[model samples]
Target: MSDAPTTYTGAVKPGGPADVRELGGLTLTKVAVDAQMSNNCYLLRCRSTGEQLLVDAAAEPETLLPLVGENLATVVTTHQHWDHHRALADVVEATGAATLAGEADATAITEATGVPIARTLSHGDTVAVGDCTLEVIALRGHTPGSVALLYRDPEGTPHLWTGDSLFPGGPGRTTTPEDFDSIMSDLQEKVFDKLPDETWFYPGHGNDSTLGAERGSIPEWLARRW
Candidate 1:
């Protein structure tokens, strides 16, 4: 194991509304950028191995590029959405990292980003960065191919980077008529019920919360589920 420290720093663009938070570790730097007041884009770095992972490359690659550069190893999208993929082409150009998304959304991601989908991911796949691993969990509520990345801190507490699955107060929106029930069912059975109460949720939008907080809001969510 490397003996590097995990440090985080935040920076805001001069004329832009986005804020970039750089979390540095022994081998990786996890950079989270708050974009368009709602979406988030993350960059994971492996210092020892020089491998990096870019999660949900949203708009403003001009703002996100210097941090990503040649160190990027792969780009993984939680799901394919306009706001999330708008900056992908710039990222691909800068890092040459293979872009990955769910099989169900690959075509849409490709169409939206104008970049080929290099790999299709499914539930239970492990995305590795040096010795760290993020296990994929298909949430499938907000979008057909929506997924969550589950990782553990040194203490073993679960930390989830849910693309658009479960947010601070609830899960993401379901526009397709066929996805409403599946999205809610998946939330209750796969996400809310399966993960421990202590799991920290880093959603695609809003502030971070825990599974316990989200579980408590299920009734409120169900009441509004339409």
Candidate 2:
């Protein structure tokens, strides 16, 4: 949406990155497809219960259907970025899954994907699927409505599906005067500082990382410091 180059673009391959890992009894799969060449999506499944949550479906519905099976509980968009919501309509129609995005993203989601969102989410809201719970954390640097999902494992390690908010080595860009300060401060205090050191980061567009790994990069964000 910011004219930034899209990342994932290619034929819909059957398998994703071979090294897909299982954490906290959930199978995490990354689907890298679409014109942006971005990490178009992620499928989080509870291995024991079989319930699933689809995060940021970036391609057409048909392209994502094979990757998502009958157990999908809901589709949650991290933000209203075009690459992230391009396939919203198809997914909703195909799975009949309720779509949820940040409260501020509902309008854009409806406009871009032509589908009325079933619910709006905000910080602290919890969406439950099977035995897993995804707690919403508003992370608005990249976009006004961007949010992250936090899942705490039994061992106390937190797994974050940080849309485009906090990436491997840097936080998402703050493109305007109003969003630059408030969002960055919120991220540092509310997200970065609060997350445990061992938290795993499953971002929207890259290889997975850990909170400790990203913590080392905070200094780089000094230039954008509020």
The per-model lDDT (C-alpha) reads: 0.72, 0.75
In candidate 2 the C-alpha lDDT for residue 75 amounts to 92
Best by lDDT: 2
Among the numbered candidates, top TM-score falls to 2
Candidate 2 deviant stretches above 4 angstroms: 1-19, 224-226
Which residue pairs show backbone clashes in model 2?
Answer: 6-36, 7-36, 7-37, 7-38, 8-34, 8-36, 8-37, 8-38, 9-34, 9-37
> Candidate 1: misplaced stretches above 4 Å?
1-37, 176-178
* lDDT for each residue of candidate 2 in 167-220, tens digit (9 for 90 to 100): 767777677766766677767887888987777777777666788877777766
